[model samples]
Target: MKEITFYLDFVSPYAWLAFERLPQALEGLSYHLRYRPVLLGALLKQHTNPGPAGIAPKRAWTYRHVSWLGHSLGVGLDMPARHPFPPLPLLRLALECSGDGFVNRFVAGTILRHVWQGGADALDPARLDALRAALADQLRQDEDAPERAKRLLRENTEAAAAGGVFGVPAFEVEGRLFWGLDSLPMLRACLDGDAWFDQHWERAASVPQGLGG
Candidate 1:
């Protein structure tokens, strides 16, 4: 079975949606899903891509689209008051509880649910402390766990950037990067060896002067 690396950050509602639906989508498929934590802000800065919330039009459309997607997927997704919340603490927690795949999924799901579904503040220190306490038994039991987790997050972000990942809810299958939550179907097609799955896009120097050009 091939391994699919799912690079995510909790700040992204799209990532939350992907987390909710991916397991069901991948059922009966011969692919292993690996969760990786990366800083979306850093990725944006490094790639010079404007964030969804930073643009007024995109932000308005994103909320509506995400809500519609949630309904389609039968998953509850309520955008928190703080849309672009700080994801560092949650990312660190995921790293601290990283050994077991199930545990990692649980931790990531819990954090995502709290922020997206529960309407809780993702950056609230109290909320983070409560979550950490809830998973105390599962997290790393070292005094330096926080530091170790931070380091791991940095390494993961650097590795992801090096591997051509520039966004959240991205997937990598056999070294091919499929970005965005909408790319899940394409990723699945690639994994299934579908003949129609073409990863290439033709590039042109200038727009054709036919209709709107």
Candidate 2:
């Protein structure tokens, strides 16, 4: 009966890519998922962590690496440059789906697919509405669909911000925070009773460049 709270913003390409593996990573493991929708730009302005795009050299390097990672993961991801909007509406849709006890993996999957598979305009309302229609059709839901979707998005975003989240694809396990989708494997390991958390003083060669407030 362990739990993981995932904080995420829709605008992040890395979050989309990370979502590709996280669901499966949780399989066969005892865990519950709590999704929190937060704003990435707000967090970036907080003087805490910097976005990957801020560092031209590192950003370039990460994109190349992400290309290879996507290939390995069998996920189709458009290059990061193409998708630059926040994923608030989409994440709200996911939360709304969860309320029905039918986690719309398709919506989640489509979000990932659109973001990484040469389909970079996933944030467009038209595209999102179409996706929602398809998902609702799949789920056979017909009541006030648009309104509900909007409500879900707003509520979740506010709740996410209130939860101390400043980024997307963040995972919290019983109060321990794991930011970024790349950290999911570590989160999984921690939940499965790994002792990686017991040690201290695992210092980096330098402070993460943007971590200075």
User: Whole-model Cα lDDT per candidate?
Assistant: 0.81, 0.65
Model 1 per-residue lDDT tens digits across residues 76-177 = 998886877678878888788864322367777877887798776777788878888877777988787778888888988888899988899898887778
TM-score of each candidate structure, all chains considered together: 0.88, 0.70
Task: Kindly list the per-residue Cα lDDT of model 2 for residues 1-213, writing each as its tens digit.
Answer: 997766666667677777878878767898777555555776667646667767888777878877787788887766734545665666556655654322444656665665566654767667767777766644435566556656656665566566666677788787667777678778888888886665531453235787657
Clashing pairs in 1: none
Question: Could you tell me which 10 consecutive residues in candidate 2 have the lowest summed lDDT?
Answer: 198-207
- What's the CA RMSD for each of the models? 3.7, 4.8
What is the lDDT for 86 in model 2?
A: 63
Model 1 scores worst on lDDT over the 10 consecutive residues at 197-206
